[model samples]
Target: MERKGESRGKTPRAPVTERDSSRSPKRASGLSREVVVSATAVKTANPLAEEFDLSASKSHGQEPLPVSFSSPPLLDGLRESVLQALGQSASPTPIQALSLKHLFSDIPEWRQYLLASETGSGKSIAYLLPMFHHLKKSELALPEPTSSTISSRSQRAVNPRALVLAPTHELSRQLSSFAKALLHNIKLRVLCASRANVKSTPRATFTASKMAAQFTDDADGTLGMPHLGVSRPVDVLVGTPNKLLEMARGRRWDRVKDETDKQLAAELSGSRSETSSKSPEPEMGLQNVEWVIVDEADILFDPDFQESTRTLLADVAAARGQPVPYTPDLLRSSPETSTTSTLTQNTPINYPFNLILTTATIPPSLATYLDVHHPTLTRLASPKLHRLPSTMKTEYEGWTGGNKDADIERRIRKVWAEDSIRSDFNGKRSKILIFCNKGTKVQSLGAFLEGKGIPNVALTKDSGARNFGNNHHLDGFLRTTNYKPKPKSSSLSEDKEPHVMITTSMLSRGLDFSPDVRHVFIADEPRNMVDFLHRAGRSARAGQAGKVVVFGKLKGRGSAKATEMKKKVGALRK
Candidate 1:
């Protein structure tokens, strides 16, 4: 039988290698674990207990966050599955609906140009369904082996053959867990690509349409270190762009053994031991890679991130199986393809690649540029940029005139009321995502929330609690340090989903948190239409209704866009 989640990305090492500026590892075990309890529990608190109510969480562990629904929905199985996997239930977002038809079939050719919907349209599911089906089918075809010993050292690894490149550690972690949950009872190899963790015994793999395994060193022992027995072909590898790029670069560690002279010196110093004379083996590195998934393409594929993304694309493609050396017509976009492009502006015979790029919005100019490099791209089209509902209310408070901070404070207090929010969470709390334009404003708002004695926290790029590795062109830090939030007496719990997370656009795209997110507070003015829509998409996710709260001053309030949105929805109804 084909394994449900066959390995996605695993390949042999290439001859050429490169290095990254911020090569570091990040551990996401801290905040991620608590999210389950906080998001699932119904604000279940043990009154006098400083921490959350563990018993309450267990009792309602299966309960989902409350998302508004105006009508009797038709999706029963889908809703149950979502709530079981993600702790929330709502109809498929517009993107999910649009992608449903595509997902029901095996259209391996239509993988590229998959920019269907915006931030909260559940695009994660759009691509994942096809990937799961393909992996499962691939697994079923292979014969059951008795042992994991590599018959061929060069072709040791089995299965793993896909790559998912998200923008942040949090998002990558979220995707891995999500896929793992869905592909349960199947053979799959999912790996993360942060330079932080060291792959002690890096296994080599040979496969097609997969990703290379990249491991990180973990001293805390929270994340289970995945063991590869078969020198096995890996199937899926997911990580941020920089970490994957570093793994693909395959840096060689120059290990020099301690000489016997040093042992003699240590003996003279009276601290030598007989066991200190063991021989050391040569250092090793990552191997072949295959499939590639730019999970959140919008953030990582922007102009700023082109260099690293391009470099990663070239390296991963160069190491993939078959299709041999560079050719004239080989370079093109083929959804999930990792080939490099062959041409550039004013340059006809540019480089070629099988790079698959997807996002909610793809401008004509950008499409043209990509066409120059990917002449054979199959640009998929959708009626709208995103499939999220427009019925969600959108409010804008501007500050073009005076001190808008006061106004913002007054409103946040009104909508996200401390007492009512707690009661709402107690009755049924929903995950809340808050967005802001600048880091300073995020800090200011957080401080205000604290000053008001509200139990809340803020997550920004520059939090003193964060030690990021590199900027890596991602909206988030390429890698993070041990610095995380000081464990709050009030942290997100499974039973009580993340009721509120003050953030930037960093949380906009990577992970999937839909209709369940009932409230969104945008504390700053959107710079452009793209920014506005991206921020707006956070409120009403999946098919659940939601409320959007924008913080600004009235003098500069611009509802022109909002008016247009209402008009469009109205036209659709008519």
Candidate 2:
């Protein structure tokens, strides 16, 4: 079957280009570099590589990894649910297809993998499908419990079977939405715990009882027996690392309850007393997690999130009766010289649960980190992992110093006017994404564009974008607009002008824009190849053609910076 984004019939394999240091100029130290492959190389040329246009390798270089194109027969209900969730996409993308092969295989080592593929390649579905299938299978395997056993288990704390972690609240919510769609026909429940959700709801009203009611199971045990007394069990838990860490650590509810009761009594009697002490309760729910998927591995592993992420992973290991594989000190030490007390070269360590890390690009540092820390991690990479989409056209404009903002405004007007006359315009206003290096620039540029009579919206980390929630400006900008202007309604008509969104790098990764976004304007040069790829990837998604225009200064120190960025872009395109 043909994939959703590709053309009809078979696509011929493009030649792979390995990175040769002799053929290119030397790059500065500490900058991560990846081998360049053609974006059109969606078919494998090597016989050993097999189907799905994927290359399977090991971090430790132990042996040739096996490949499979066939997917095991899924349960009838699950198969239908998966197909329904996929919607018009009848077949899996290359990455999803390859991931299914290993996910259902008998090999235990294949359980742990690093899924590296380009943007818009259906990475979320690649992992979610297998996760749902496995969780369902495990549920069906369990025998019916007795009435007494049900009562006892219901009193116990919640222990989720699957956990998905994302770097941001918006990404976590998106992942949760996809998972919920997949489980629509099935009885399984998916829960999302994020700061956004918490902040939007009242603390008193956001109790476990209220959240549990939303996911309560019906009679006949279709949704599986509830682990919590009043709430349905969570099959999959998706959230940000900080929030999940807080949930996993739990709270001292007994002490809080005692303190509240004492305070009420004292209020009635006009007396004061010391608070009571109570032992802490068990964790909210991570003890029984079977599968842990870390989305956006690069961001999650960085210094900003490294500590919390490591602590959470260690907690999971401890709960699963396995040794903690990663620690701050261990991560700092050289992998060649570092040794674990629980692990030896001669011993084969058995992990209790499957761990999957997914990313769009595999930088040198990330590659090395995984190799040393997770030596047995199976690598599943698409042929276009580090390459830009073949259909994207990039334009570089030089800015020679003064009046940079004016220059950008003129360019925006030109692009907007050009888009207004396209044959496929369909009378609806097109959208453009303008990316800045900092949030302050985003605010200033957004205000400048508004003053220039352009309809625009700005989204920064603190701007509360939250995927268009509560941000009416962003909502109107992103919404479909094709209304006819009424007579004497020139102001209303101006609101329907071509929409432009100004934002910082916070919106660069994992956010999917509408097809109307055909142009990406980089107001500032990207810091690195990874940043450039993600920002450019905002357009030309799902095999659609798009354009990226980069504006850079061409004088003084800016000139040198622009020249260097130009070479990097050229290397990416090559």
Candidate 3:
């Protein structure tokens, strides 16, 4: 049976694979001193990496330093399910431990922060805890809506207490998974806008198609319902900007009702008992959101999403003025409590919700914008930008193979040859991640590897879509790290031959790869320092020792741009 909450379309089934016993393990090899020296020419380590002692020190390195708690400080209030989801690894990462201390510290008002941390430093968990903390507290303090100004159902449907905006569908889905874990066994409902329901072309066409589908009673019954803005009950919502706005505009719901209410009322009088008993669901909106988080704020503020982000911010800002509707029972029983000095109607509340923006990189314009809009934002930066993790051994080599395809094929062969030997001797599979600049290259290379009988997959933005191909790209690549294979899939089995993942920037940052990744092959040099850092970050994650190889021509180590980038990287390391 299909899961109750699963969205439309079928999830692709992963392929099966069998090992080739002909390959034998070879002795592990180390980089030559000359190659090591060249690679270090552009290495940069994050200055903040030294701030906290990775071994025994548990306190956050800050003014009001966090006292070492027996366990994660916020674990007490979190649901057991959430804790269970976190499992033994619940101990906070350095970034999470430090950010939580200041973010949740006692203050006069809600705190605003701009958090910059290294990739895979547990940034998601850092903000997620605080969001849940605030929402649980608010749910207790605030009464349910019962205002005659709007239907209780309608108000409840459209009002989301917490809003999280991500740049991509995959990121939003990732956030939704974490949010669900934290909300386990709780009354709250978390909604993630599926990419399938979202339309990007012809605004009018999108509106018409969405509304027509939603007006019916038997709509998919998921969050995608266009009329859901004012009708469905969603406490936490994670989505891309354009899709979010499509579902957030409550006025559209009101307009729908205004046009249909009369006809519906007439039909109710004439219809049979079963039909008459049914009523339209409430329209959805973002009326009383309490927290707004922009994950990957740098991407959210980028040119591609900037306009939609501005519109979303404007909508949330407008929703702020209207207070949360109160239940009649609470009003009658505790008028004084409702109008307490802290929450008095006369005393203006600061902007309706708390704002948190998180990213590894904050562009200058975004910095300027934050300075103006959220002047009080707590500036949190790792002592320096996160450089490559120390656990990774960097390597540089020039590509002597003629032509692009030849260079790529040669590099793949070399890595596979070395890894095969390591696998036989060490009994450990060497998961390799290869980086390419473009999607077509990734696909072509993946196809090429398949032809060579090497297990490989290509992951990109389109890979996450429903109709991109029949292959299960996202599912297959995600399992590469944890070794959790779907039922009857020999390819995902740990005993199966080690698989290689060829990808673009889509899998470069934020997304977690398997700790088993033994090597990262930079088929193409990153364009800049930031790209270099994120690419290198793909390996040596969570303190695991790994290797990184940047290939170039035999005469020259790496591309011209890569050489220049290396110098800047070397300076940062120095």
Q: Which candidate is the best by lDDT?
A: 2
Name the regions of candidate 1 deviating beyond 4 angstroms. 1-111, 143-160, 194-233, 251-290, 321-356, 386-388, 398-403, 417-432, 464-500, 514-516, 556-574
lDDT of 2 by residue, 535-556 (tens): 9987877677788999987666
Arranged by TM-score with the best first, the candidates are: 2, 3, 1
lDDT against the true structure, per candidate, is 0.44, 0.61, 0.54
Best by TM-score: 2
User: Considering only N, C-alpha and C atoms within 3 Å, which residue pairs clash in candidate 2?
Assistant: none
Q: How far out, in Å, is residue 47 in model 2?
A: 30
Per-prediction TM-score to the true structure, in the order listed = 0.59, 0.75, 0.68
Candidate 1 residue-pair clash tally? 91
lDDT ranking from best candidate downward? 2, 3, 1
